[model samples]
Target: MFTEARLYSPVTRTGDGDVTVHLSEEHPGVRDPEYRARRNAIAALALEYVPGAALPRIDYTEDEQRVWRTVSVELARKHRRYACTDILDAAARLALPTARIPQLDEVSAALAPLTGFRYVPAAGLVPLREFFGSFAERTFHSTQYIRHHSAPLYTPEPDAVHEIVGHATQLACPRFAAVYETAGAAVARLRTDAALKFLADVFWFSMEFGVVRERGEIRCYGAGLLSSYGEIEEFRGAELRPLDVRAMGTATYDITHYQPVLYCAESVTHLEDVVGEFFATIDDETPARMRARPVSPRPAAAARPRGSA
Candidate 1:
């Protein structure tokens, strides 16, 4: 199935005239011709309805600007404390470029070379299957907007704070990149909805909100925990158990409340290995029902009455 891209137009006001920034349905500044062509094809599918339609203008008031500045400062402070220095040093050693609230163009240029992944600035939420499909094809969806200080601690949906500060930094690592790509591939191969639901549980538990032990200490790794001010403390200090997928079964998390527990991994490599193995094992198993089906009563000769001595 083809994915549709949504276009957005963000506006800024000045003394002279309103300045509008358009995020084209078509991704721009992608160096690879083949990658650009693939995005263009997707865009063509998206624009069947949009057809170059201009988006509604977003006006930023003085108060909004102040809120944004304050939020940026707070985010920067958190970034300094939580960001993995080893990852940053590795990125720098590899001469990987960095950005503060990078545009899709910048992310696309950086990621496309490492993997075929390119950034798409989503207008709203995409279906889980579609999101997984994009990852299978090495495309990462991101939102263009940033969260404001008014809700510094929480946002209903992922803004640039979670996308850039939390997710993109880890994408720079090669091992983590392979893990994500493999998980996406597994998601794409599953035919049944039950299997998808099970895998999503696995993803939610590990990839989005997992932690790992390093040097005899627990540390924040998952993007969800890293981005959230409250979760970071809770995940590290609270009760955590080893993630045993087979025993625990599939489960969903409460997004609004601080997580009471988190899964711990021996190392990042071990986490990747375990996920890969779990998918392989589950792919072969038939989904078991939680409840038994009713059966009709048997004949007197074939069945014994209850409590017969």
Candidate 2:
């Protein structure tokens, strides 16, 4: 359930417009079979909008808005403890004038000055290659949908909570944004599917669920970890290691539970340096045949489940 302070009313748009939906914990049930089916359908549609593909505009009802807000607030509350003050400060600075769902055109206009990226309305899940490809081109593919308030913690394939609030605000920061671009290009240049998979795993661990040491304290920077209320305590007390690219092949990580271990970078520049080195190493190799092979759509088989129980 969501707190009243976090529950927001849905805003509507007409004539092929997009809106953010905030869900209430009690209303707009999350267990409805129809809702799940619709979401799955959307996920399928999202997959179709892979690299070089454009997504179609979509509409949302008031119910959807409530769901989005519920999840967004839950994520914000959960990660508040581990959040980087600097990143949060930047987010606060870039906060929209209103709490209403942002129109795609409006989002694009706001981000135009900072980066060439534009918000593309999507409904389905995107493949990893396409996902990284979007970042490589500075085009951030975002979903126009929101989760139900009743299921604030539920994972909706690609919801607005994860894309907009979790990642977009960070994208507005120059250093962070550059990391995304550089990482994307490296993924593209890697000549083997296995290498790409290894890199993706590194990204999954660090970017999506990573933590960092700041001023003698560990803080959350990975959006996936920062957006979940359940993860804050786990990550803070979890074992952390310095990121080692050479050891990535033998490295294993927890993906299901709140991460119990994390890899740290002394600084953003160090993180960037490591990625640059990995990219250079891969580029020096004889282009592997696997490079042209498509990445798997399913989650990595070796990915450690949550909790490791």
Instruction: Write down the RMSD of all candidates, one decimal each.
Output: 14.7, 9.4
**Best candidate, lDDT:** 2
lDDT per residue for candidate 1 within 1-309, as digits (tens), equals: 111222122223346533333333422322435433333333333323232243222233453345445545664455455544434443443332222334555666676666556666554455667766667677676655543334545554455556755666566666666666776777767777766666666666676677777777776666776566555545655557676564223443445455555677777767777865665455524235311323343222221111100
After TM-score superposition, what is the CA distance of residue 66 in candidate 2 from its true location, in Å?
Answer: 2.1
- Native-vs-model 2 lDDT? 0.57
Q: Looking at model 2, report the run of 10 residues with the lowest lDDT sum.
A: 1-10
Off by over 4 Å in 2: 1-31, 40-57, 74-80, 96-98, 156-158, 248-250, 276-281, 284-309
Q: lDDT per residue, candidate 2, 45-125, as tens digits?
A: 553455445454446566666665555565556546567765676566556433455655566666677765677755433
Q: What is the lDDT of residue 217 in candidate 2?
A: 80
What overall lDDT goes with each candidate model?
Answer: 0.53, 0.57
TM-scores, all candidates, are 0.65, 0.71
User: What is the Å distance of residue 276 in model 2 from its true position?
Assistant: 4.6
Q: How many Å off is the CA of 114 in candidate 2?
A: 2.1
Off by over 4 Å in 1: 1-100, 247-249, 280-309
